[model samples]
Target: MIRLEALAKRFPPERQALQGIDLEIENNAWVLISGGSGCGKTTLLHLIMGLDQPSQGKVFLHHQHLGRLSAQARARLRANIGLIFQEPHLLQRRTLWENVAFPLELAGQFGRALRQRALESLEQLGLGARATALPAQLSSTERQLACVARALITGPSLILADEPLERLDPQNAALVTDLLRARHRAGGLTIVQTCSESPATLPDATARYTLCAGRLVPSGLLER
Candidate 1:
């Protein structure tokens, strides 16, 4: 579960990005940080992922204060949280499988075990056929899938995706969304995704909240 308490971030002349965000995300939940551009949706993700520290509030992951962690501790904590950025964010020089395996290696798993795990991840993401393909050669949707596979291959507890289907055509987008829902259904998986317009991704979400004017507004009930 994730909790945000009095979360406020201000950039002096740039205006306030978030103001007094108080919310709770339960385990086994899929919630969209619904919002328009510049509404601090992405900023909220950063706070959750511990990529950026809050200006005057606290972010708690499973009841542990994220702000209390050191830099190295923060990295360790992020290993337990998978993130899919708005962009594919893959390395051009690396092959598709290599990019997916990067996180595993960074986590200290290696050798044939690493290769097997990476291959399995690609297989699950339906990118097994393109495992050897380089990032520059893959299509936007393909790269996006690879990025998602990279995140899941590590088996993180939570998934935080920013504009997950930003560039895909309907078909590819649906495919990815379906896969995400399947994972959510499997349990104890907390997924926080942001999309400009809502897509019927998961049926058993915990709740849905909208971000506007730097505040979180309740949208509706989310359940099966």
Candidate 2:
């Protein structure tokens, strides 16, 4: 489970990014947090992912308090999570398959087995034909799809996606959304996706909330 208690964050010179946000998300649940830009949606996800510390209150992942963990420990915990940034962060020098195989390489896997696994991941995302291509050679949508493949290669229990659909066209957006929904239905994946769109846009979300001026407000789905 993931829990946030009175969570808050502040920037220099009196900028409050988040304030007194309280929330709880159970395992294997698909939750969507929707809001406009600068509403603290990204801030909340960063706190939950242990990438940043909360100024006040606490964030707990599976009962472990993130604020109390050392930076190294937080990084160790992060290895098990799948993270999809708003922008694709692929390596310009590497092939698509190589980029997808990165996490596996870090975990000490290599050679034929690693290459095969990476190929399979790309194939699942309909990027098999582009596996040998460089990030610079792919379209924006394909690059994002590659990012998704990389995130899922580790088969993480939790995925944190920030504004995933923000820049995609309709068909591509549906492709990404359908893939996430299929993974969730296949079981044991908990997804926390943030979007600058309405909750209704994500009909597959099991729970929904909105971030408004640094405050978290439960949507009708949550209230139900």
Candidate 3:
């Protein structure tokens, strides 16, 4: 489970980015956090991911307090998570398959099995033919899909996606949505995604919340 207790953040010169945000997310649940830009959605995700510290309150993942974890320990903890950034930060010098296999490589998996797994992930994202292509060679949509492929290759139990559908056209956005839904339905995957505007066909979230001016407001359940 993921829990946040009175979470808050402030930037230099007293710019409040988040305030008194309390939330809990159960395992295998899909949660959507929606808001306009500068509403602290990304900041919340960062705190949850242990990429940033909260000025007040605490963040717990699987009952482990993130603030107390040492940097090395936090790095170890993050190995279990799949993070999809708003920008597809692909390695310009690496092939798509190589990029997807990166996490596995970090965990010491190599050889034919690694190659096979990477290719399979790319295939699942409909980028099989572009597996050997460089990030610069692919279109924006393909790069984003490639980022998705990399994130899922590790089969993480929790997925943190920041504006995942932002740059895609409707067709590609639907494709990405369907892929995430399939994984969530397959069981054992908890997805927490942020968006400026929720998609029309977004799957019913286990819970939906909106952030405004650094405060989290429950948006209630979405109807099918």
Candidate 4:
């Protein structure tokens, strides 16, 4: 479960990114956080992922406090959280295999074990044939698929994506969307996604929220 109670992230006098937002998302629930650019949608994800700090209020993951956790504890918390962005953001110098191995390597798993896990992720993304290819060699869509593969390789309990469909055709978009929905259906991950205005269909999001003027408001199911 993920809960944001009176959550706020203020920048300065000129910019109040998020203003006391309140939300509740149950386990295995798929949610969409829709908003205009810089409405604090991505900030919400960052705070949840422990990438940024909240100016005030509280963020809870399975009823665990986020702000008070130590750095090492936060790292452990992050291990169970996956994040995908607008682009793949792979290393230009590394091959697909090496890029996918990054997270596992960071976690201290190494050798053939790390290679095996990375290979499995590539296979899942249907990019195993291009495991030796560098990021420079892939199309934008393929790069994004690699990002998805890396995020899911750890079998995370929660997945957060920021504008996950920025550059893809309808066919490829649907394929990736279906992939996310399938993960949601497996009944363990709490998936939260942020997008500007989606193409009409989204992963079976159980709840939806709209962000405007720094406030996060529920949009509900029938609103779809």
Count steric clashes of candidate 2.
0
Q: Which residue segments of model 3 deviate by more than 4 Å? A: 222-224
**What CA root-mean-square deviation does each model show from the true structure?**
1.7, 1.7, 1.5, 2.4
Better of 1 and 3 by TM-score: 3
* Candidate 2 residue lDDT tens string, 44-143: 9999999999999899997899999999999888888888988898999999999999988877899999999999999987899999999999998889
96-150: candidate 1 lDDT, tens digit per residue: 8889999898888889888888889888767899998999899988999898888
How many clashes in each candidate?
Answer: 0, 0, 0, 0
> How should the candidates be ordered by TM-score, best one leading?
3, 2, 1, 4
Per-residue CA lDDT of model 4 for 68-178, tens digit only, reads 898788888877678797767998898998888877777788899888888888887678899989999999888988888888877788888888777766776777787
Q: In candidate 4, how many Å is residue 194 off?
A: 0.7
Over 4 Å off in model 1, which ranges?
A: none
Candidate 3 lDDT tens digits, 131-182: 9999999998899999998888999999999999898887888888888998
Ranking of candidates on lDDT, top first? 3, 2, 1, 4
Cα deviation of 164 in candidate 2 (Å)? 1.3
Pairwise lDDT winner, candidates 1 and 3: 3
Which candidate leads the pack in lDDT? 3
Candidate 2 residue runs with Cα over 4 Å from true position: 199-201, 222-224
